[model samples]
Target: MTSRTLPRLLQTPAVLLLLVWMLVPLGMTLFFSFIRYVLNSLRRPEWTSPSIDNWRGWGNYEYVLYSAKDFWFAVQNSLFIVGSVIALTVGLGLAIAVLVNRNFMGRGIARVMLISPFFVMPAVNAVLWINMILDPVLGLNGLAVEGINAIVASLQTMPIFGGFFSLWPEIEPVSFRATQTSAMAVIIMVTWQWTPFAVLIFMTSLQSEDQQQKEAAILDGANAWSQFRNLTLPHLARPIAIVVMIQAIFHLSLYAEIEIVSRGNGNKNLPYLIGEFASNNIGAASATGIMAVVLANIVAIFLLRIIGKSLMD
Candidate 1:
């Protein structure tokens, strides 16, 4: 056999195995999506089992699209949370990465501390943020607001500043668990956790940047902002694209954080919607899962195009 032919033959088993591993679940999900499958059904016993007799055609998809009120909201919320997290992480990561790139005292320790947040488990991160930091009554958020109000109250007792302090209204701590703010809570915690990931990628890319080019720019009377805007940003384009793509894929299906933060109160994403459907209606859950796969693919394709363009440029 030729050398390349031999290697291809050897790799065939692994390639086939991987394909089967991915395709099997996808096939099952597709099958379930087209049928009336559920865990328990007293009205229709046959619907509980997965069989051809329970065929639903596109009924489940129709139900999800037209009947289910949360499907569209979940889709919108999922995209919102993912987009917000990506924006925050990328911006903060770029700023922190650039700041830490400079030589300074305790640089090594600072790098370690900055990257440490990425190691926190997603569930744990959510719990900590929602309970310890963002809680309206018990968390640091409430304490800080309370402290500011207290200081204002004390100032209102003073002679000259009393009138000014009286004009200031009492500040109420925000309830992050509320329907309006639950999604923001998710975004904030997720951004905190994932920013370190972006930092790591950007920092590694920045280390490989051409120092001579930077020195030349400095000698040419370019300010720090000019060097960053022209030189550093261009050099880091590929890394930024990579960070965006990977984070988009990950945050698209966020579940643990959503569950811990809101329990589907007002911040339900597609995955959480699937979970809610799965508790009883397997067919609807499977249908949602299929749609989620499609959504993820569309996002990945869009981001891939951006990556490809960055590579070409």
Candidate 2:
């Protein structure tokens, strides 16, 4: 065999395996999506089976798009959480990475500590932040808020500042359990966990920066802020693009963190919404699954375009 033929032969099994892995479930989802199917029904139990007679055409998609209010909300919340986390992670990560990249005592240990959060499992991270840190009644959030209130109340009882303190209302701890703020809670935990990843990437990228250019800029009497904006920021453009793409792809399908923090308690992303539909209405769920795939493809294409442009520079 030719050299290229041997490589192709070696890769054939792996390629075929991956094709089966992806296409099988995708085919099933597509088929089920176009037919009427549900987990439970007393009338016309045949509706539960997967057959051409139950063909629904675009009815499942129509139900999801038109009848379901949560679908739009889930889409909105998903984008919101993803965007927030990306902004937080990239901003905080760049700052931390720049600080940690400097030469300082115990810098090695500091780097280790900074990156430890990224190594933690997502579920564990979610639970730790939600239960140990954010729980309104028992966690630091409640305790800190309660302590402030007590201090305010005590001040109100004092003669000198009693009137002034009485005018100030007591502060309330923000609750992460409610639907309105659950997505926010998810965003916080995910950011905390993923920021370290961004830091590590940026730190590696920073090491390769042109120190000679920085020295020249210094000789030119460029201020630190100017140097950073004109030189450092441009050098980091590609790394920033890569970090954004990876984080966006990962965050778009976020599930464990959301489930642990919110449990879809009125807050849901596409994945959680899909799970909800899958519990009974398999057809709708399948249709949602297909739509999710399409959405993911759209996002992936956008990211590729951005990353490609960055790399070309």
Candidate 3:
């Protein structure tokens, strides 16, 4: 066989599989979106079956856009969560990567511990953090607050400083399971899990730093901060973009952490919103799913442009 033909033959299975995987479900979703389909409908039994006779003609999209109360909220929340996580992971990852960049005792162990969080299942991370670490009455938050108060109480019995100590306010452990705080908890857990990923990526990038240039900078009286600001940061620009986009993709679809943390009490991202609508309103869910596709594509395009520009060099 010709070399070109051989390559095409070898790629056929993957190309066919990918086409099927992409088209089948998405085609079905499109078909469903244009029809009045539902799991159970007592008032209009015709709506229970998917058929061309019940064509919606953008009715579903309109209903999701205008009628659904949670659609905008979910979009905003999704962007907010993804944005916040990217900001934090990038910042913390840079600092931690710098901290562990130099040789130190037990640096390998520290790196292992830092990276271990990334491997934990999202469900387990949420459960462990919400119930064991952040629980108001049962977790370490409560115990630490109680301990602080006890210390303050003991200090209050001291001679001259007793009055000052007595005036100190008691500490209250934050209950992270409530509506607003539950979202915060989800954010915190997700950040912890993903920051390690940022660290690993940045650290790998750091290993490619120009050491001779760094040495020259030091010789030229460039301080650590100046060196980092001038050289290290510019070197890290591409990797930072890569990390941001990857994290954005992962966090935009965040579901298990949100589900396990607070079950979308007050913090439903787009995916969670789609899941909720899918329970009772398949048409709305499909419309929202299409919106999600568009949102993800926008991000993907922007990221791919950055990556492609860098690749050209």
lDDT of 1 by residue, 1-313 (tens): 7779988999999999999999999999999999999999899998989999989999999999999999999999898899999999999999999988889999999888888888999999999999999998899999999999999999999999799889999989999987659999999989999999999999999999999999999999999999999999999998888888888899988989999999847779999999999999999999999999998898799788877776866
C-alpha local distance difference test of each model: 0.92, 0.90, 0.89
Arranged by lDDT, best first: 1, 2, 3
- Which one wins on TM-score? 3
Q: How do the predictions measure up, each by TM-score?
A: 0.93, 0.93, 0.95
- Candidate 2's C-alpha runs over 4 A off are 304-313
Count of clashes in candidate 1: 0
Candidate 1 achieves a global lDDT of 0.92
TM match of model 3 to true structure: 0.95
| Cα lDDT over the full model 2 | 0.90
**Order of quality (TM-score):** 3, 2, 1
The worst-scoring run of ten residues by lDDT in candidate 3 lies at: 260-269
Which candidate has the top score in lDDT?
1
